[model samples]
Target: MTNLIRKLWVPVMTLMAITGMGQMPIFKRYYVADIPGLAWLGEPFTVHWVHYAGAAVLMFMVAVITIRWFADREPLTTSGTLRITLLALLICTGYIRVVKNLPDIHFSPTFTMLIDWTHLLFAMLLGVAALWSARTGRRSYTKQTESLRRI
Candidate 1:
């Protein structure tokens, strides 16, 4: 179960990010409609709902993973710690963005843009870190297997 969740974490976050991007006015205005066969992605309202739904699922998954990791007393490597920190920050920024979007809330345009950009930056960093972690894990695994074969 934990292995499955770990495998899914990156792809699910990537999809959420993509759907979130689809809700951006600039993307909708300049790109979404122009792309053939993908025009439906420009529907802001639907995309917004989908993004929210994905966020909810993401939060749940993170909670479960964190709990399981602690319960199992898994050793946290530096990369694992970094990923957890990034995820925490990402979730914080995401919640702020959601609050800013509430009907009665009124953040300054500059503040809103700052939050949006920060969220995107965190997501990109997290994705790169995940890839790096996977690559390093594979390399170490290969080295271990090679040593075993030599023995």
Candidate 2:
């Protein structure tokens, strides 16, 4: 059970995060319009529901990884640390941008540029980290299988 969970943990978390990353507008349009019994769901309610749920799941995953990173009790690679940092930054910047108007904060051109650029940069870095992790995982899996076959 432990081995299975260990093997499946990251992939499952990644899937959940990716699912949560989907745009809410598209979800609202298709799900409420095409699906039955969903028409009664107000646009704001549905949008917030899906968005918040996904954000919660992603945040949970982030917390788990962050705790693992800080506790020094788990084996986390440099790539993993970078990935977590980038993900955190990405999520935070996104949240700020989304809520920027809610606070009635005056949006200057410079501030807007900084937020947009930071978000894009972190997103790109996260993509690189994800690719690196995937490649490393595949290599490790291949080595393990090869060793098992030898036995």
Candidate 3:
């Protein structure tokens, strides 16, 4: 389980964010439209499947990491902690938006827009952070390999 998580976390998060980001433009366009510009995407359940499914897996992974992090008794690294925090926040905002901004849900225009933009902003930041984290991990991996070769 630990090994699987270590290998798959970044890829999973990256893929989820990509799909979520891809869905955003359509979401925004049709969020308040009369004819519903994004009907081509799919029915509600189909469109939401990507978001909800990714979120479920992500939450499960986060729970696993949180348990392991506490169990290991290791010092928390700042970057790792920050990344986790951001990911959690992103998931939370995404959930709230899902509940609040649906076509059937009638929220104030300002409030709906706020949730939409908030979700987008968090998603963007999380994406950038994930990319940076992956790059940093690869650099360390390369450095270790080079040192091992020298040895």
Candidate 4:
């Protein structure tokens, strides 16, 4: 349970940071592929931002349960389990960028170059965060079970 709380803390904080960033207009019309692009009527930032926000909310609940488990000296709850599933989706999102789609937008070469660089940099950050969370989450489950068995 202590491990669970430790594992969930980073992801919850990351999700909160992502949501608090509000919508960054990274791509306007087209998506990086695989992810559904924005429609003519809707803005891309809003959709992407909402997805990240939803993920944060789900992670927040997981964090709450994990903290509770640690406090009560109980097993990590299903909230922790659900968070693992969400982490898998985040991994898939990273893979999608590698395979079917990389976001491209035609812009003034100077600005576009900077944008591309910035985007790739942020992508690396996200990839690292997602993998770390998944690995940590898995370890959390293992620790919980092992500890429970000792009792």
Which one is best on TM-score? 1
- Please report the candidate that would top lDDT against the real structure: 1
What is the lDDT for 109 in model 2?
A: 83
Rank list by TM-score: 1, 3, 2, 4
| Sequence-dependent TM-score of model 1 | 0.78
lDDT of 2 by residue, 4-120 (tens): 545655665554343333333454555654567545333655544565565666566556655644564454456656766787798988787677646777788899889868876
Question: In what order do the candidates fall by lDDT, top score first?
Answer: 1, 3, 2, 4
Candidate 3's residue-wise lDDT over 87-138, tens digit each? 7788787888778857787878898788788878887786787678677872
Candidates 2 and 4 compared by TM-score, better number:
2
lDDT of 1 by residue, 1-151 (tens): 7678768876788779788678776566877566897666788887788889889889888888778766756456677778788888889999999999889999999999999999988888877887898887831211223445698
| Regions more than 4 Å wrong, model 1 | 25-37, 138-151
What TM-score does candidate 4 reach?
0.32
Considering summed lDDT, which 10 consecutive residues are worst modelled in model 4? 32-41
Better of 1 and 4 by TM-score: 1
